[model samples]
Target: MNQFESLSRRAIQAPESGIVAVVNHGRLKAGLIPLWAGEGDEKTPDFIARPAAEALLAGETFYTWQRGIPELRQALADYHGRLFGRQLPLDAFCVTGSGMQAIKIAIEAVVNPGDEVIQITPAWPNFAAALGMSGGISVAAPLDYVEGSWSLDPDRLAAAITPKTRAIFFNSPSNPTGWTATPEDLTAVLELARKHGLWIIADEIYTRFFYAGGRAPSFMDIMDEDDRIIFVNTFSKNWSMTGWRVGWIVAPPSIIQVLENSVQYQTSGVPQFMQKGALAALEYGDAYLETQITKASAARDLFCDALTGTNRVVTQKPDGAFYAFFRIDGISDTKAAAIDIVDRVGVGLAPGTAFDKGGETFFRACFLRRLDHIEDAAGRLADYISSL
Candidate 1:
């Protein structure tokens, strides 16, 4: 067999990230207002970065606790208490390298080879990609998209479960769609998991980015103590620490050790200095987070209005999250359209083809940026759509 064919089937069959492909094409272009990635255009605030740099310089660079440092975990507990109004035990938190790692760990913990995980779509592509790498299958339960709004249908989700299904990977205030689940939606999905004896991997990293006054509704608001839910979150969004690669998991205490063991085997643990920074973020970054939310709220309005003004884009201001996912009236092949838009307009956008099913005809633009930049990108994109 050839060298490529000799690799494991899982490794050989893994799909390239469609988002990254477009990014690679446009990354070098001058004056590109890139909005393809799911991050804000801010650096880690001094309050958070200074401590980590000090810690690293002061020799805090050793291997650390597999779960996390006690202070950081406790801080996570406190943060949850404030955000979710429920005080969770420190044992429930397991630190991972990033939110992506947390999802992989969750998949490894609950899914065996050939097991299926039902994910809501059009969803972030990473969960399915990670599941496939772990030898599990990803089954899609696409959301209901009507007009410019997206929502869940309980019966549709319940229909996706099968005898081999082991878990449900749910991302609210979703990456591309910006579809925030309502309390009623959360309750129905929780009830469905209760009936099916399936685990839930909740990705609520965008909860704080909600534009509707307060944070988005979460599974924590309604789950019982014994419910099988695992929360995967990151410091990337709220604190502008995407490059830090620090995230944490909140699972039942009984499974924290199991998840930590997975950590033990993969990456050992997040770097100690980084954990110190994360602690600072949980401790002193609330106001900074609020500022990011405010920026996102305004950008959401401005960008959505600009797109809708073109009358060739189908979108509304998303209920939450920092992205505006819309379909241009004449663009059918989004992957090619993304490349053309970036080349012609100098505005980088993620093609809906990167997102899973039900998203193939759309484009996603991250709007968490300076107002002027958003205005510029929006104006350029509006002109592009007008020309179309």
Candidate 2:
């Protein structure tokens, strides 16, 4: 047998990344006006990046703390407090390489090999891989689409719980589909966790990108100090610092130590310059973030308007995030559909199957580009659907 056979089974068997991999394969040659990733097409704000550049200039690139620099942790704690109206202790917060890493660290802390974890469908595909890497089996609980929106069925999710279920991963202002969990939805999930004694890993990376209202409600809003919830968030979306790789997890003090130790081996710490940049963002990046939010909201509206009368497409007005997830009524081959659109219509999007098995008939469009580009892409997408 080949020595690398196991590697092929483990890595090759992994699910394909819907949009990211497609975009990578297509590159600029695809002639697709790319909107396949979750990040905005804007660069990090000057107020956030300037300090990091200055720090680099000062030659302060050495390692700091394993968990995080105290200043950055404190800033994150303060930001959490401001958003949720409660004081989150610095000791309960641990920083990681990115929001993605935060999820992996949290999963590693709680899940053992063969433990079952439930993930909501139409989720960020990376979540599943993170759980798999930790030797946990992923159980998908799909959301139902109703009246141009997506929602979770609490009873179905509750029923999926088993004694071996260790955790459930949830994303709000969710990636691919801009589905923001409502207050009731969060409460119900938390209640299930309480009943089953399971962990709730909430990814709130896109929390600040809400478009329907000023702010998206968080699980933290309703959670108490005693709740078994680990809230993951990052400065990536709001501060336009996707490349900075600064994110944090808020858990009870019990799991914080596990996360701290896990990250110590995985990555010593987030870079000092990046930590300083994150602190500056928390302190002074609000105005710039607000401006970007306005632009994102406008782009979302433009896309929605463009798809209004398209026959084969059905999309809900997203409440948060920059994505517009829609069903291609008769298209079953989302991967081929995505590739076809890129080659023929010059618009790039993610196939729904990347998010979950139930996503085969769906497609996701990112609206985080310039308004004109968004309008143009939407028109191109409409034309493609019409041709189909």
Candidate 3:
């Protein structure tokens, strides 16, 4: 028997991230146009970047507040007010290392061993793995993509709730499937949460990419300040600061307090200089986002147009977020298709199985590329489908 066999069973059993699975399958080759992971190609704007350099030069390297610098938290509070007209109190925020870390923090704060958390799928793979680390179950309630676009069926989600269900987490303008849950849909889920006394975790990393309502209507929009809901947001998506690794959670004071303590174990504080740049992101990143939205909308159109040349797949234009999730005929195993595309077309895409079994015949492509590149990738994908 292996010496490491005594390690935590859940840790060993948990799957590696699907994004990594694509990479492991062969993505390191030269000249492969990569669109597998969910991030934009844009650089962090100079307005945000310069300040972090300035802060670093100004010797702001030391640790700061455990929750986050007051300036950054308040900046986020103001930003939320500008979007939702709900001026969140400063007490409701906790700036974690990244949106992923914020997810980890929320999973830690709310889930108990052997408890269940219902996730709206297809979800980011890390969500399930994180829950497993805490010995919590990640039960998926898949989205209904019936009319070519993605939507949450409130009744389906409500039915997924069990006596052991402790929480529900959703991402809208979701990754992999650019579905933005409507305000009515959110309210119904919130009602379910209230009925079951379940925590609500909202991952709003892509809220800015939403096609309507300025920003996607959020959990905070319909929630009472004291409700058991936490919002996971990031500078990564909207501000283009993925590598900078900064994100925050919006929750009740009790949850924030718990996070502040738990963070001391995971990461005591986000870098002080990085928080300064985050301050700049909130102050000045709006214009960059507007420009990006315009470009992203065009990119989305170009991607859909190119995909139209292929008769094998069906997808509506994504209403929000940056991905195009579509199903293909004749491909019962999407991972094999993903591998074939990578080998033949020199384009890397994620198999649907990475997201959930419900997505097995589907594949996800990030359109966060130059419109020309997106078109080229789509053409290649179309050729592959035609060959099949």
Highest TM-score scorer: 1
lDDT of 2 at 297: 90
What digit string (tens of lDDT, one per residue) describes model 3 on residues 1-388?
A: 5867988797789887766777777657777878887877888888999999999999998878989999999998999889878877898899999998999999988999999999888877888888998899989999987846777888889889998999998888887788888889889988999988999888888888877637787887778865898888888877778899999998887667889987788889999999999999899888888888877888888887777657677888888898888887778778887888888998888888888647777788888778888878888888888888
Q: How many residue pairs in model 1 have overlapping backbones?
A: 0
lDDT score at residue 266, model 1, on the 0-100 scale:
95
Task: Predict model 3's lDDT versus the native.
Answer: 0.85
Residue by residue across 19-121, what tens digits does model 2's lDDT show?
6667876677644688787788889878888898899889879978888888988987888788778897889888889888888888988899899999888
Error of 1 at 364 (Å): 0.3
Which consecutive 10 residues in model 2 have the weakest lDDT in total? 8-17
> What's the CA error at residue 68 for candidate 2, in Å?
1.0
**Where in model 1 is the C-alpha error above 4 Å?**
none
Q: Rate the local accuracy (lDDT) of all candidates.
A: 0.94, 0.83, 0.85
TM-score versus the correct structure, for each prediction: 0.99, 0.96, 0.96
Error of 3 at 347 (Å): 0.9
Sort order, TM-score high to low: 1, 3, 2
Model 2 ranges with Cα > 4 A deviation? 6-12
